[model samples]
Target: MKKAYKKVDFPTEKIRKFLEPGPIVLVSSRWEGKENIMTMGWHTVLEFSPSLVGCMITAENHSFDMIEKSGECVINIPTVDLIDEIIGIGNSSGADTDKFNKFGLTAEKASIIKAPLIKECFANYECKLVDKQLLSKYNFFIFEVVKAHVATSSKYPKTVHYLGEGIFMVSGRHIAFPEKFKPENL
Candidate 1:
Protein backbone atom coordinates (compact mmCIF):
# COMPACT_ATOMS: atom_id res chain seq x y z
CA MET A 1 0.00 0.00 0.00
CA LYS A 2 2.91 2.34 0.74
CA LYS A 3 6.28 2.59 -0.89
CA ALA A 4 9.43 2.80 1.19
CA TYR A 5 12.21 5.15 0.11
CA LYS A 6 15.82 5.36 1.07
CA LYS A 7 16.78 8.02 3.55
CA VAL A 8 18.73 10.98 2.28
CA ASP A 9 21.11 13.14 4.20
CA PHE A 10 21.51 16.87 3.55
CA PRO A 11 23.74 19.45 5.15
CA THR A 12 22.01 21.58 7.78
CA GLU A 13 23.44 24.84 6.45
CA LYS A 14 22.41 24.08 2.89
CA ILE A 15 18.90 23.05 3.95
CA ARG A 16 18.49 26.23 5.99
CA LYS A 17 19.46 28.34 2.99
CA PHE A 18 17.00 26.47 0.78
CA LEU A 19 14.17 27.18 3.28
CA GLU A 20 14.82 30.89 3.29
CA PRO A 21 12.33 33.70 2.42
CA GLY A 22 10.10 33.12 5.46
CA PRO A 23 8.47 36.13 7.11
CA ILE A 24 10.44 37.83 9.86
CA VAL A 25 8.22 38.24 12.92
CA LEU A 26 9.13 40.35 15.92
CA VAL A 27 7.86 38.43 18.93
CA SER A 28 7.43 40.28 22.23
CA SER A 29 6.66 38.77 25.60
CA ARG A 30 6.36 40.13 29.11
CA TRP A 31 6.78 38.33 32.41
CA GLU A 32 6.62 39.83 35.91
CA GLY A 33 6.39 43.25 34.22
CA LYS A 34 9.66 42.80 32.33
CA GLU A 35 9.29 42.77 28.57
CA ASN A 36 11.53 41.31 25.89
CA ILE A 37 11.50 41.22 22.13
CA MET A 38 13.12 38.87 19.67
CA THR A 39 13.05 38.24 15.94
CA MET A 40 11.77 34.88 14.72
CA GLY A 41 11.75 33.40 11.23
CA TRP A 42 10.08 30.11 12.04
CA HIS A 43 6.42 31.10 12.45
CA THR A 44 3.26 30.45 10.49
CA VAL A 45 -0.50 30.70 10.66
CA LEU A 46 -2.12 27.52 11.90
CA GLU A 47 -5.86 28.22 11.83
CA PHE A 48 -8.39 30.81 10.68
CA SER A 49 -11.58 30.62 12.76
CA PRO A 50 -10.00 31.39 16.09
CA SER A 51 -6.82 32.62 14.44
CA LEU A 52 -3.95 30.49 15.69
CA VAL A 53 -0.23 30.77 14.95
CA GLY A 54 2.73 28.52 15.65
CA CYS A 55 6.26 29.68 16.41
CA MET A 56 9.40 27.83 17.35
CA ILE A 57 11.87 29.42 19.74
CA THR A 58 15.07 27.96 21.01
CA ALA A 59 14.85 26.95 24.68
CA GLU A 60 18.01 28.86 25.41
CA ASN A 61 16.45 32.21 24.43
CA HIS A 62 15.30 34.50 27.19
CA SER A 63 12.07 35.18 25.36
CA PHE A 64 11.23 31.51 25.65
CA ASP A 65 11.19 31.70 29.43
CA MET A 66 9.09 34.87 29.46
CA ILE A 67 6.55 33.49 27.04
CA GLU A 68 6.29 30.30 29.02
CA LYS A 69 5.61 32.16 32.23
CA SER A 70 3.25 34.77 30.84
CA GLY A 71 1.39 32.55 28.38
CA GLU A 72 1.06 35.45 25.98
CA CYS A 73 2.96 37.31 23.30
CA VAL A 74 2.59 39.79 20.50
CA ILE A 75 3.70 39.09 16.96
CA ASN A 76 4.72 42.18 15.03
CA ILE A 77 5.06 42.16 11.28
CA PRO A 78 7.52 44.87 10.34
CA THR A 79 8.12 46.68 7.09
CA VAL A 80 11.25 46.92 4.99
CA ASP A 81 12.22 50.13 6.76
CA LEU A 82 12.96 48.15 9.93
CA ILE A 83 15.41 45.74 8.37
CA ASP A 84 18.50 47.11 10.14
CA GLU A 85 16.74 47.15 13.50
CA ILE A 86 15.52 43.60 13.00
CA ILE A 87 19.00 42.32 12.28
CA GLY A 88 20.39 44.14 15.28
CA ILE A 89 17.77 42.77 17.63
CA GLY A 90 18.07 39.25 16.26
CA ASN A 91 21.80 39.15 16.80
CA SER A 92 21.69 40.43 20.36
CA SER A 93 20.04 38.87 23.38
CA GLY A 94 17.52 40.75 25.51
CA ALA A 95 19.21 39.42 28.60
CA ASP A 96 21.99 41.98 28.15
CA THR A 97 20.15 44.90 26.55
CA ASP A 98 16.63 46.23 26.21
CA LYS A 99 16.07 45.51 22.55
CA PHE A 100 13.21 47.97 22.19
CA ASN A 101 15.15 50.77 23.79
CA LYS A 102 18.33 49.91 21.89
CA PHE A 103 16.52 49.91 18.57
CA GLY A 104 14.53 53.07 19.46
CA LEU A 105 11.32 51.23 18.66
CA THR A 106 8.12 52.58 20.12
CA ALA A 107 5.55 50.32 21.72
CA GLU A 108 1.85 50.55 22.48
CA LYS A 109 -0.34 48.57 24.83
CA ALA A 110 -1.96 45.55 23.26
CA SER A 111 -5.72 45.04 23.48
CA ILE A 112 -5.67 41.45 24.70
CA ILE A 113 -2.18 40.75 25.97
CA LYS A 114 0.27 42.21 28.44
CA ALA A 115 2.98 42.27 25.78
CA PRO A 116 3.38 45.54 23.91
CA LEU A 117 3.18 45.82 20.16
CA ILE A 118 5.83 47.53 18.06
CA LYS A 119 4.32 50.83 16.90
CA GLU A 120 6.31 50.97 13.67
CA CYS A 121 5.29 47.52 12.55
CA PHE A 122 2.61 47.36 9.85
CA ALA A 123 0.59 44.71 11.66
CA ASN A 124 0.47 43.35 15.21
CA TYR A 125 -1.26 40.30 16.59
CA GLU A 126 -1.91 39.70 20.26
CA CYS A 127 -1.91 36.05 21.08
CA LYS A 128 -2.28 33.75 24.08
CA LEU A 129 -0.44 30.47 24.34
CA VAL A 130 -2.88 27.58 24.07
CA ASP A 131 -0.39 24.75 23.91
CA LYS A 132 2.77 24.28 25.95
CA GLN A 133 3.38 20.56 25.72
CA LEU A 134 4.95 21.04 22.32
CA LEU A 135 7.16 23.82 23.64
CA SER A 136 8.42 21.69 26.48
CA LYS A 137 9.15 18.73 24.22
CA TYR A 138 10.05 20.32 20.90
CA ASN A 139 10.47 24.05 21.60
CA PHE A 140 7.36 24.90 19.60
CA PHE A 141 4.75 27.33 20.89
CA ILE A 142 1.23 27.51 19.53
CA PHE A 143 -0.85 30.58 20.20
CA GLU A 144 -4.37 31.67 19.45
CA VAL A 145 -4.69 35.16 18.06
CA VAL A 146 -6.78 37.20 20.49
CA LYS A 147 -6.69 40.52 18.69
CA ALA A 148 -5.00 42.27 15.77
CA HIS A 149 -4.05 45.84 14.89
CA VAL A 150 -2.99 47.11 11.50
CA ALA A 151 -1.65 50.42 10.29
CA THR A 152 -4.14 52.53 8.42
CA SER A 153 -2.34 53.44 5.22
CA SER A 154 -2.95 52.99 1.54
CA LYS A 155 0.70 52.71 0.61
CA TYR A 156 2.01 49.22 0.00
CA PRO A 157 3.76 47.65 3.00
CA LYS A 158 6.95 45.73 2.42
CA THR A 159 8.16 42.99 4.75
CA VAL A 160 11.61 41.50 5.22
CA HIS A 161 12.25 37.77 4.94
CA TYR A 162 15.17 36.05 6.64
CA LEU A 163 17.47 34.06 4.38
CA GLY A 164 20.11 32.79 6.81
CA GLU A 165 22.76 34.15 9.10
CA GLY A 166 23.21 37.79 8.01
CA ILE A 167 21.35 37.68 4.70
CA PHE A 168 17.83 39.13 4.30
CA MET A 169 15.32 39.53 1.51
CA VAL A 170 12.40 41.88 0.87
CA SER A 171 8.88 41.10 -0.19
CA GLY A 172 8.42 41.49 -3.93
CA ARG A 173 5.44 42.03 -6.22
CA HIS A 174 2.25 40.17 -5.53
CA ILE A 175 0.97 37.54 -7.93
CA ALA A 176 -1.96 35.13 -7.97
CA PHE A 177 -2.38 31.79 -9.64
CA PRO A 178 -5.51 30.00 -10.74
CA GLU A 179 -6.71 27.08 -8.68
CA LYS A 180 -6.80 24.76 -11.63
CA PHE A 181 -4.51 24.83 -14.64
CA LYS A 182 -5.48 23.48 -18.06
CA PRO A 183 -2.23 23.64 -20.00
CA GLU A 184 -3.28 21.28 -22.74
CA ASN A 185 -6.89 22.49 -23.06
CA LEU A 186 -6.04 26.14 -22.82
Candidate 2:
Protein backbone atom coordinates (compact mmCIF):
# COMPACT_ATOMS: atom_id res chain seq x y z
CA MET A 1 0.00 0.00 0.00
CA LYS A 2 2.99 2.33 -0.29
CA LYS A 3 3.14 4.86 -3.06
CA ALA A 4 6.02 4.68 -5.49
CA TYR A 5 8.68 7.35 -5.31
CA LYS A 6 9.76 9.47 -8.27
CA LYS A 7 12.83 11.63 -8.84
CA VAL A 8 12.65 15.03 -10.44
CA ASP A 9 14.64 18.25 -10.60
CA PHE A 10 13.62 20.74 -7.89
CA PRO A 11 14.50 24.30 -7.08
CA THR A 12 17.21 24.67 -4.45
CA GLU A 13 15.51 27.66 -2.85
CA LYS A 14 12.32 25.68 -2.39
CA ILE A 15 13.96 22.82 -0.53
CA ARG A 16 12.51 24.14 2.71
CA LYS A 17 9.14 22.96 1.42
CA PHE A 18 10.32 19.43 2.17
CA LEU A 19 12.93 20.01 4.91
CA GLU A 20 11.22 22.41 7.28
CA PRO A 21 12.52 21.53 10.71
CA GLY A 22 10.40 21.43 13.84
CA PRO A 23 7.49 23.76 14.63
CA ILE A 24 7.07 27.49 14.34
CA VAL A 25 7.97 29.54 17.43
CA LEU A 26 7.13 33.06 18.50
CA VAL A 27 10.32 34.90 19.47
CA SER A 28 9.82 37.83 21.84
CA SER A 29 12.49 40.36 22.60
CA ARG A 30 12.84 43.51 24.69
CA TRP A 31 15.33 46.37 24.65
CA GLU A 32 15.30 49.78 26.32
CA GLY A 33 11.63 49.41 27.31
CA LYS A 34 10.67 48.44 23.76
CA GLU A 35 9.16 45.00 23.27
CA ASN A 36 8.38 43.08 20.12
CA ILE A 37 7.38 39.69 18.80
CA MET A 38 8.26 37.94 15.59
CA THR A 39 7.20 34.60 14.19
CA MET A 40 10.17 32.35 13.48
CA GLY A 41 10.51 28.92 11.89
CA TRP A 42 14.25 28.80 11.30
CA HIS A 43 15.25 27.63 14.73
CA THR A 44 16.73 24.32 15.77
CA VAL A 45 17.83 22.55 18.93
CA LEU A 46 21.56 22.18 18.66
CA GLU A 47 22.34 20.38 21.91
CA PHE A 48 20.66 18.83 24.92
CA SER A 49 23.01 19.14 27.89
CA PRO A 50 23.57 22.85 27.45
CA SER A 51 20.06 23.31 26.11
CA LEU A 52 21.43 25.14 23.15
CA VAL A 53 19.27 26.51 20.38
CA GLY A 54 20.21 28.25 17.14
CA CYS A 55 18.08 30.54 15.02
CA MET A 56 18.45 32.98 12.20
CA ILE A 57 16.84 36.38 12.55
CA THR A 58 17.35 38.71 9.64
CA ALA A 59 18.97 42.05 10.49
CA GLU A 60 16.06 43.86 8.88
CA ASN A 61 13.66 42.46 11.47
CA HIS A 62 12.86 44.81 14.30
CA SER A 63 13.45 42.07 16.85
CA PHE A 64 16.98 41.37 15.61
CA ASP A 65 18.40 44.55 17.08
CA MET A 66 16.51 44.20 20.32
CA ILE A 67 17.56 40.63 20.94
CA GLU A 68 21.14 41.29 19.91
CA LYS A 69 21.51 44.32 22.13
CA SER A 70 19.69 42.92 25.14
CA GLY A 71 21.33 39.50 24.83
CA GLU A 72 18.12 37.79 25.89
CA CYS A 73 14.75 36.73 24.54
CA VAL A 74 11.93 34.29 25.14
CA ILE A 75 11.05 31.60 22.65
CA ASN A 76 7.40 30.74 23.00
CA ILE A 77 5.74 27.79 21.34
CA PRO A 78 2.17 28.42 20.27
CA THR A 79 -0.39 25.78 19.33
CA VAL A 80 -2.51 25.54 16.22
CA ASP A 81 -5.21 27.72 17.72
CA LEU A 82 -3.00 30.80 17.45
CA ILE A 83 -2.41 30.34 13.75
CA ASP A 84 -3.97 33.68 12.93
CA GLU A 85 -1.76 35.55 15.38
CA ILE A 86 1.30 33.76 14.07
CA ILE A 87 0.54 34.77 10.51
CA GLY A 88 -0.26 38.30 11.54
CA ILE A 89 2.97 38.69 13.49
CA GLY A 90 5.04 37.32 10.64
CA ASN A 91 3.37 39.51 8.05
CA SER A 92 3.63 42.73 10.03
CA SER A 93 6.71 44.44 11.39
CA GLY A 94 7.16 45.44 15.03
CA ALA A 95 8.66 48.79 13.99
CA ASP A 96 5.45 50.76 14.29
CA THR A 97 3.10 48.09 15.60
CA ASP A 98 2.74 46.89 19.16
CA LYS A 99 2.44 43.24 18.27
CA PHE A 100 1.10 42.20 21.65
CA ASN A 101 -1.65 44.86 21.54
CA LYS A 102 -2.31 44.49 17.85
CA PHE A 103 -2.65 40.71 18.06
CA GLY A 104 -4.44 40.73 21.44
CA LEU A 105 -1.81 38.57 23.14
CA THR A 106 -1.03 38.92 26.83
CA ALA A 107 2.59 39.49 27.80
CA GLU A 108 3.61 38.01 31.11
CA LYS A 109 6.80 38.99 32.91
CA ALA A 110 9.67 36.54 32.59
CA SER A 111 11.56 35.42 35.67
CA ILE A 112 15.16 35.96 34.56
CA ILE A 113 14.97 37.80 31.28
CA LYS A 114 13.39 41.19 30.70
CA ALA A 115 11.58 39.86 27.64
CA PRO A 116 7.99 38.91 28.42
CA LEU A 117 6.43 35.59 27.68
CA ILE A 118 3.29 35.12 25.65
CA LYS A 119 0.82 33.71 28.18
CA GLU A 120 -1.22 31.84 25.56
CA CYS A 121 1.73 29.84 24.29
CA PHE A 122 2.05 26.16 25.16
CA ALA A 123 5.68 26.50 26.28
CA ASN A 124 8.12 29.31 27.00
CA TYR A 125 11.90 29.09 26.96
CA GLU A 126 13.89 31.89 28.54
CA CYS A 127 17.06 32.21 26.55
CA LYS A 128 20.29 34.17 26.77
CA LEU A 129 22.53 34.88 23.86
CA VAL A 130 25.58 32.64 24.16
CA ASP A 131 27.25 33.01 20.80
CA LYS A 132 27.03 35.37 17.85
CA GLN A 133 30.02 34.54 15.68
CA LEU A 134 27.71 33.55 12.87
CA LEU A 135 25.46 36.55 13.13
CA SER A 136 27.44 38.80 10.84
CA LYS A 137 27.72 36.22 8.09
CA TYR A 138 24.48 34.26 8.34
CA ASN A 139 22.27 36.27 10.70
CA PHE A 140 22.35 33.21 12.94
CA PHE A 141 22.14 33.41 16.72
CA ILE A 142 23.03 30.82 19.30
CA PHE A 143 21.13 30.87 22.56
CA GLU A 144 21.12 28.91 25.77
CA VAL A 145 17.82 28.14 27.42
CA VAL A 146 18.22 29.30 31.00
CA LYS A 147 14.69 28.49 32.09
CA ALA A 148 11.70 26.67 30.63
CA HIS A 149 7.94 26.60 31.28
CA VAL A 150 5.64 24.07 29.72
CA ALA A 151 1.97 23.21 30.16
CA THR A 152 1.15 19.87 31.72
CA SER A 153 -2.46 19.71 30.66
CA SER A 154 -1.57 18.15 27.32
CA LYS A 155 0.94 15.39 26.73
CA TYR A 156 1.83 16.93 23.39
CA PRO A 157 1.06 20.18 21.67
CA LYS A 158 -0.76 20.46 18.35
CA THR A 159 1.86 22.69 16.72
CA VAL A 160 1.93 24.08 13.22
CA HIS A 161 4.62 23.79 10.57
CA TYR A 162 5.08 26.20 7.71
CA LEU A 163 5.50 24.84 4.21
CA GLY A 164 6.26 28.18 2.65
CA GLU A 165 3.98 30.32 0.50
CA GLY A 166 1.33 30.73 3.22
CA ILE A 167 0.87 26.97 3.55
CA PHE A 168 0.91 25.23 6.90
CA MET A 169 0.51 21.69 8.18
CA VAL A 170 -0.79 21.01 11.65
CA SER A 171 0.90 18.43 13.82
CA GLY A 172 -0.96 15.13 13.77
CA ARG A 173 -0.84 11.82 15.62
CA HIS A 174 1.80 10.21 17.81
CA ILE A 175 3.59 6.92 17.64
CA ALA A 176 5.81 5.28 20.22
CA PHE A 177 8.01 2.19 20.04
CA PRO A 178 9.90 2.03 23.27
CA GLU A 179 10.50 -1.69 23.02
CA LYS A 180 12.37 -1.28 19.75
CA PHE A 181 14.98 0.95 21.30
CA LYS A 182 17.89 0.01 23.54
CA PRO A 183 17.65 0.86 27.22
CA GLU A 184 20.36 3.50 27.09
CA ASN A 185 18.91 5.01 23.96
CA LEU A 186 15.47 5.16 25.48
Estimate the lDDT of model 1.
0.74
The C-alpha local distance difference test score for the whole of candidate 2 amounts to 0.82
Model 1 ranges off by over 4 Å: 1-21, 177-186
Estimate TM-scores for all models: 0.81, 0.88
Candidate 2 C-alpha error for residue 155, in Å:
0.6
lDDT of 2 at 2: 15
Cα lDDT listed for each candidate? 0.74, 0.82
**Clash total of candidate 2:** 0
Q: Superposing all C-alpha atoms, what RMSD in Å does each candidate have to the true structure?
A: 13.1, 11.1
lDDT of 1 by residue, 1-186 (tens): 111112122222222121223678899888887888999999766665567777899999999999988999988777777888888888899899888788888767887679998777776777899988787788999988777765556234577887896777888887545557577522
RMSD of 2: 11.1
Deviating ranges (above 4 Å) for candidate 2: 1-21
Worst 10 residues of 1 by lDDT: 1-10
